[model samples]
Target: MDVVQQRFAEWVYKLGITLTERQAEQFETYFRLLVEWNEKMNLTGITEREPVYEKHFYDSLTIAEAVDFNKTSSIADIGSGAGFPSLPLKIAFPHLKVTIVDALAKRIRFLDEVIAALGLDNVTALHGRAEEVARDAIHRDHYDVVTARAVARLSVLNEFCLPFTKSGGVFIAMKGTDVEEELRDSGYSAHVLKGEAREVLKLKLPLEQSERHLVIIDKKGSTPKAYPRKAGTPLKSPLVDPAASQ
Candidate 1:
């Protein structure tokens, strides 16, 4: 193995994650494709071998710390820019059924290509506004777990993600920092959306030592139909405060 692979393997091993030879190969292939496609369009700014291995690949797998993948079968990643946690998690746990939703067609195309190249089964990429997608009968309240990786604020993110999680499922929002303020701002929105803050997990990235927070929200009840609003409404006017009318 090369330096990047060696570091990734070590990191995973240190974290008590088992990395089989095949899974390592898949990650290597994914890194190669990410760099190759990034040259064509804006796939990611962090394309260097080490950073990709550390920040993108390893960072994505950090979600496993919040929940046991063995118990979680289905996952939906909203605004899956560069397919962070979802794709990496899917690669690590081959049994997962992953659905990635993104607004940009180009990103979806990249995800599709990556899925096909990796020969990954039970993974689907959807191109559309997350708000509209979540409102659809097929997607609404259907996933075992829904995730958004630093997509937006907790309030906006709750609308984007909570609508898709099945009752009793969880929405895991990946954030960089300021998790406390986000949770305070998002509590009302979560309540409005029929979700409750379940847990908040903090961990530092192995190499960079950057702070990461996984805000886990349980979908205790059905989301109000008004949610997600329209395509761009949630971002423009999120439910930051329950009293504020949208």
Candidate 2:
């Protein structure tokens, strides 16, 4: 095994994920494709071997700290730029049923290429706005977990993600550590969208040691029909707990 795979295995191993030799090869293949395709179009700014392994690949797996993929079966990733957290999670678990939604068709194309090249199964890439896609019955309230990474604020992200989370399931917002203000601001969005806020979980990236966070919100019930507003409303006018101004 090469140094990248060796170090990646050691890191995720601490998270209770043991990588088979094939899994290691799959990650190597994924890394090559990421750099190759990125040259053609905008996929990710971080494309170097070690940083991709550390920030993109390993950073994605840190969700394992907040979630038990062994117990979870399905996940939906919203505005999944470069498929952080989901693609890596799929590579690690292999059993996960992953649905990735992105508004940009080009990114969807990249994800499809990666899935096909990696020989991954049970993964679907859809091209559409998150708001409209979440309205589909098959996607609505149907995932074991829903995730968004650096997509939007907690308030705006709730509208983008919570609609896809199954009742009793969880929506995990992957973010940088400065989320305290966002958590306070997102309370109304959660309440309006039928999610109960959970404490933000934190973990640091290896080597870089920069703190990352997972903002967890448990789905209390089905998304109210009025929710999510329209395609762009959630971004333009996110719900805020009016009482917070008091």
Q: Against the unseen true structure, what C-alpha lDDT does each candidate score?
A: 0.89, 0.91
* lDDT for each residue of candidate 2 in 1-246, tens digit (9 for 90 to 100): 888789989999998899999889888888998899899899889888998999998999988988889999999999997888899999999999999999998888899999998999999999999999988999999999999999988999999999999999999999997898998889889999999888788889998999999888999999999977889998888898777667
lDDT of 1 at 133: 91
Model 1 lDDT, full chain set: 0.89
Q: List the residue pairs that clash in candidate 2.
A: none
User: What is candidate 1's CA lDDT for residue 142?
Assistant: 92
Cα lDDT of model 2 overall?
0.91
Using TM-score, give the best candidate's number: 2
lDDT of 1 at 213: 88
TM-score to native of every candidate shown: 0.96, 0.98
Deviating ranges (above 4 Å) for candidate 2: none
